[model samples]
Target: GEAAFAHKGGMHVNAVQKVVRSYEHIDPASIGNVRRVLMSDLAGRSNIVMKAQELGFKITSETPELKEILARIKQLEHEGYEFEAAEASLALVIRKILRHREPPFKIEGYHVSIRRDRAMTVCQASVKVKVDGVVEHTIAEGDGPVNALDQALRSALVKFYPQLKTVRLADYKVRILNSGAGTEARTRVLIESTDGKDDWGTVGVHDNIIEASLQALADSLEYRLMKK
Candidate 1:
């Protein structure tokens, strides 16, 4: 495959990706590798043919589906869902392949209201985030509704896991959660942020909005921090 990627320098990933730190100068993570998986070569899969057979995928190099799956995987990897982080993101995708049960977080309801008057723009955010199947929520006002909502939600989250301060919102994005509607359609928030040195994504929703945005914001910051 590196031969195919070789025609283009960018496909260099097909090589350094398999060798990680052994290659000089690439940030294992810049291409989406996490430190743990890189330090250990456990991420490589070569003798898994029998395992794939056990799962019932006919194991033959001549199998058109095998070639297609490999090609599709390398192609998706081009889009940035690096399966190396399979321990986290891809596990959810491979649940059927590995057969796991349940996921960690559930949302009850999250809401936020932003009001702007002559003097200032007010932001209030609130959220209901659950852990280990237990639920709790908090609401707060901020310099802007997003900040206040983040503050309020963080207040509750820290009580359960105090290590959250080590990380923060590296970036955030909100898209219309409801589509094809007019301006009134609520926006969907997709956040990309860091915890010291790690990055993650989270989502939130609401018509009132500030809290909904904050729901994803606070969760991304705190949960990622907790992970570190």
Candidate 2:
């Protein structure tokens, strides 16, 4: 038999390991709370709804609006959006759907161009966004295509939503889901943003890197605006 010993006051003591028979002695409410805490760590639309309700938001898994949100989540996941890594963005989607809130802006179109010259490589982005039926077009240059696109989009949006100026991208990640497809492989992009007070993550998936990045970036901005 294996035994453990503890020394106290120059005396050796043997410690015995005991096993409990069952959880029957535990309070049912306490067990339920433990279960809930475990389930919340796993990401899913139902979990999102549960968390929303816990925060005093009136929503349910079976609600039509929740169903719509789930459908959208499924569609995006199928396209390569990984909500598990971007729960903050998913929460925002749930809030917007439950409240029937309109998006602050709509993207009309965007263009990203890369040029390589003898001097240096340049990336430029131009975006068209519609706010309150008025469309604003803006252009900007960045160290890379994604940076340029982000700058251009934010420039177009800051006029209507000044809060966006305080928001900045803190990190960005990209994962190729199907490398076997070569250049046509689907890609997932995760973007983390912070407003100096709070932080959040957003995700997107697409065959084109720019498209995926744009989707994530848009979600991050929308989430911040909604929270504000």
Candidate 3:
């Protein structure tokens, strides 16, 4: 959903258009796609084939070479393994099953806030960081709870690894699993992040929506650290 603007200094709008056109003539105004690129090896290939087919390309999923891969994918998906959650990760699982990487960072704590007028829909953020046995904390505000929480986490990580500096919150969605009458509700958040190298998705759920955001934010970096 829509969140606050932290660093909108780049041509993200143009980049989005390029990707949209790369796929097909999609009307962004109608779709509300803030970012246009899809980032994943598996999604890349699948998207290409799907786009071609959707744009009237004649092809069959039953190609002798694709049958097994397709079936396996469907099997895993039916079993609850969602590649759509992390495309690079799905492909990596096959190759990296032999060896896993080490984690680079650990989170300890964080805080976020939102005020009037600035009462961001995504109003929360906090980060606890550890590097080389040393610890630090960084917090930032966002348009929503999850966005702010992730921004805080990434801000901390980027200080240690410059590569993380470019990562951006691509999309966020929240679903209420239990009604709160008004003030309290158990919510689930799905967060999507992009940094050009890869894209990933993480989920968080908790009674306090802000805490739920923290849970997902923690998983996001944990996943990234594992890759590193």
Q: TM-score of every model?
A: 0.48, 0.76, 0.50
Residues 1-228 of candidate 2: C-alpha lDDT, one tens digit per residue = 011111111011111112211322343345343212111222355454654664457876567776677576666666666664586667766777777777889999999999997899999999999999999999999999999999999999999999899999999999999999999999999999999998888888888999999999999998887776
Q: Best by TM-score, which number?
A: 2
Model 2 residue runs over 4 Å out of place are: 1-46, 54-56, 61-64
lDDT of 2 at 143: 92
lDDT, candidate 1, 184-217, per-residue tens: 7766565655656667665555664565565566
lDDT of 1 at 194: 62
> For model 2, what is the C-alpha lDDT against the true structure?
0.74
Give the Å error, residue 73, model 3.
18
Question: lDDT of each structure?
Answer: 0.50, 0.74, 0.55
Q: List the residue pairs that clash in candidate 2.
A: none
Error of 1 at 42 (Å): 27
Q: Model 3, which residues run further than 4 Å from truth? A: 1-103, 117-124, 180-184
Strongest candidate by lDDT? 2
